[model samples]
Target chain A: MRKITAALLITGLVSAGFAAKEEKKENLFEKKLMQDIKVLNEKIENLYKLHVKECAPEYIAKAEAYLDAIDGMSYINPDTGQIERTEISPMDKIIFENKARKYLAIAKEKVYSDADGDGIPCYQEIEQGTNPFEAEKKVSRAETEMKEQKVSEKPEVKKVGYQPLKMHARIHFDFDKYNIKKDYLPYLNVITRYLKAHDNLKIKIVGYTDSIGSKEYNDRLARKRAEAIKKYLIDHGISPDRIEIIGKGKEDYLFDNNTPLNRFTNRRAEFFVMEPTESQ
Target chain B: MRLLTAVIFSIFLTAGSYAETTTTELLDEAQNSIKAAFESGCPTYAPYEYYKAETYYRIAREETSKLNTKAGDAAAIKAIEWALKAMAKRYGEE
Candidate 1:
């Protein structure tokens, strides 16, 4: 009699286990949506590894959306008065679909014109009317005219290189400080000019510090510096995350750290050329 | 039968609680790492600061496993908060 009772109990337990997983099993869309989020996250992570820092913000935003969607899908089981998944709720499906569409739109824009879809969205096929990519052709012509004017006006100096992306002065800071010393902020005007001109290319205000203290401490200070720069950029109208923070502790320095002056040189941060990739 | 149900429920709750604790701990560690990076690179933000922040953010996010019941939500939220805080401190007040 005890043996029979044990077998019956085992079967009941197994059934309960199945019941627990049943909702997840039935929800095909939810499963696929979750998979998509993971795939997107992986793609972004891989690109960052390749030193493609400029494209990271858009990807990060997408990843955040995916996480939010997953969390929003929790369902309540009416019968048990407890929460249980019943496939995906309609609300959850709509949220995911909308977000997916937005991401796809961004991906499509990458192939044609700018990443932000500014001014023109994309260059449409001739048969499809106005091409967004074609807008660049006008920009190129204008740039050539401006260059010619500058050359003719100066008739000296000599122009060279593949049309410089416009240079800007990157401000460096002292250890653990965020104030834009009255002297440093002026140089940022150079950055402002570049932004005003290109309006497309972005800047990454990376922060750095020397390797003096514990590995963890320097890292935190470096982040503070980067954040200070990022906030500055946003105030100047650049989008957040467009300006990235990179903190380097004593590990990577341009000059030797033995002397105070050399250490000072090592304790500086610089701006990087942040042009959009052709891959968008 | 009631005992078995209780056991399963207890296991789920315990797992959830454990996951929550780890997420918080990882975030604390990451915050410290960011702080260390800053002090080490003193006088200016160095290149490695970015690498450290990236690593911390990535690890915190990765900790969100399938077993991470809430589907990594808590971890992701906490990580992002630290990332922004780190950014503010590095960059400037807007």
Candidate 2:
């Protein structure tokens, strides 16, 4: 009877151990999904700003497409063990929808005006003094054809032999939080190994934010996020002092601000590895 | 007299090994807990708390290596707790 009890106890302990391990894995997966959602939201916001600032009227269609794409994304629900899809969680959907609606309404208002005092809407009329649609006047097909004729007449220039150091790398972060995601540990491990293998390597991490808030706020947030990434590197056996963090905020627009879809390109973390002795 | 001494020495060695094993297990559990907290989003923790968690984890790992089971186990548990606390604070968790 004592032997049987001992066997039973060991069996119970082993089963419990396996159950705990499985639970831990499930939690990690959920965290990863949340991180992805956070990033997606930031991207949507960033793209919208870029569309507004750079493309103007073109952003309307881009914004719509982005929203459509966002709505189409789906993920496996860790809790339910099923798939689920939504542009944003019910908690976040209202905030984002309101933001999108605000931008769309403004864009429509600016682009379409009842200029002729008719009930029908038309494009905004230009003031007699101010320039008209810049795209219309900026270039002409006749001028392009003339330029192409001239370019064809000239000899092709030799390609430059200079090789640029490959600096571009994408870093992942957890949802709504600036902390580095655990999945990045593998990439970081590779980076560390590469650096240790190559003593003369120099790198710079540029952090940025989607254009959602004031420029100043985004700037601070970007800097903090970058610093956090640098800290993670230090914690993971990398030399802390060597890494540099730069915050560009919304100054560097990767996408248009017209729609949620286009804005995603702007919310990202970029790493630029430089050749040793390169100027900062 | 020598035989008695041998028996006492053997008992001490066995006891030491048992204590060491217990501490090692505790430290392992603690480390696992810390990882679990981090994996769970250390939701409320300030970055400093994660840093503290790492510090305690290292201490635990070090002590465990040295066979200082008691301190090692305590440090490991503390490390995991700190990690969770940091995440919880960051996430605004109760």
Candidate 3:
């Protein structure tokens, strides 16, 4: 007897829950409300289909507010003096419907209006012209031109067998002396001035000697000649680390070392600007 | 010494370069304008302006690659102007 009574109570509770849910659904989808807002409701559905919310959100929102307002209209029944949803007057329905229509019309107009705002509608632009977006065509053409330019800019690298000297002045040293001649000071100043203007550069001084002496003695003498140039540069405010000195010592002769003029040419200090690529 | 200073200054000018710091700042301004235009869908609505802007940006890039900072900065200014034009058109400001 206790089990049967418990089952009956459970069923009663379940039925009450279902009854509440049904009542709520009927309140929203009642025949009167459905009939009153039928056209606008379908239009709203179409607007959703079109994703028109982005185009005219203000109008769409206002139209939705009017639909919610319809639920507020009510009147008291004369017999029972109780408020009911069914007594909603035709005037209220019409007012809401008209406002909804106005907003929807504006929204639809915005959705279908001319995109360019060139005073010609998109539809008309399409009807009269072959291309609706001529301005976009110009961009497309420019993009094509840019692609052609990219292709033409590609070319094979030509590697040269020798690197041309990136330097200006070459000073000749006196025979058997490592001292810098005062006559060469103007030329040295030229390099110093260039270095001052471009601080992002390093200098290399290569000293050469004639074959008149032993390799060891010539190498030391050549180094001294290069050192003299380095000191001059440092005196002019260039950093010491920015200068590199090398002594070729009777190698890479400019002319036959037999003639005095040839030996003078051989006893020379050459300068090279260290290109940034090779500096690393 | 003053005459020497004047000569050195003139040679520095003839060295084919401009103030790097100023040019870099201008290029940054241009890049910001370009980013705003792209995010705002200006390329679709304002294609002509977008094309002009990108072209000027390309010029700026090329000039920068050649170490022509002054010309690069000028091109960047043009790019910034055109990108702003594209955004204005998108916003119905033009």
lDDT of 1 by residue, B32-59 (tens): 6555545654213333223434433543
- Give a tens-digit lDDT track for model 3, residues A1-280: 9999999999999999999999887666566667757767888888765545434444665566456445442333333556543223445445655777787788677556665545554334333221222333454367457645643453222131122233635688777898988767887898999888877677878888877779999999999999999999999998998888898888876555543434666788888765444323
Q: Report the C-alpha lDDT of model 2 over A74-120, residue by residue, as the tens digit.
A: 43433355655533233233433444455455555644444334333
Scored by DockQ, the top model is 1
Residue A118 of model 2 has an lDDT of 37
The DockQ values of the predictions, listed in order, are 0.03, 0.01, 0.01
TM-score of each: 0.30, 0.31, 0.31
Stretches > 4 Å off in candidate 1: A1-168, B1-94
Which pairs, if any, clash in model 3? none
What's the CA error at residue A23 for candidate 2, in Å? Answer: 39
- In angstroms, the error of model 3 at B53 is 84
- Regarding lDDT, does 1 or 3 come out ahead? 3
TM-score of chain A of each: 0.39, 0.39, 0.41
Overall local distance difference test of candidate 3: 0.66
Model 1: TM-score for chain B: 0.33
lDDT (Cα, tens digit) per residue for candidate 1, span A176-277: 565665556755666766666776666655566765667788777777776776677678877664565677655555444543334444555666646654
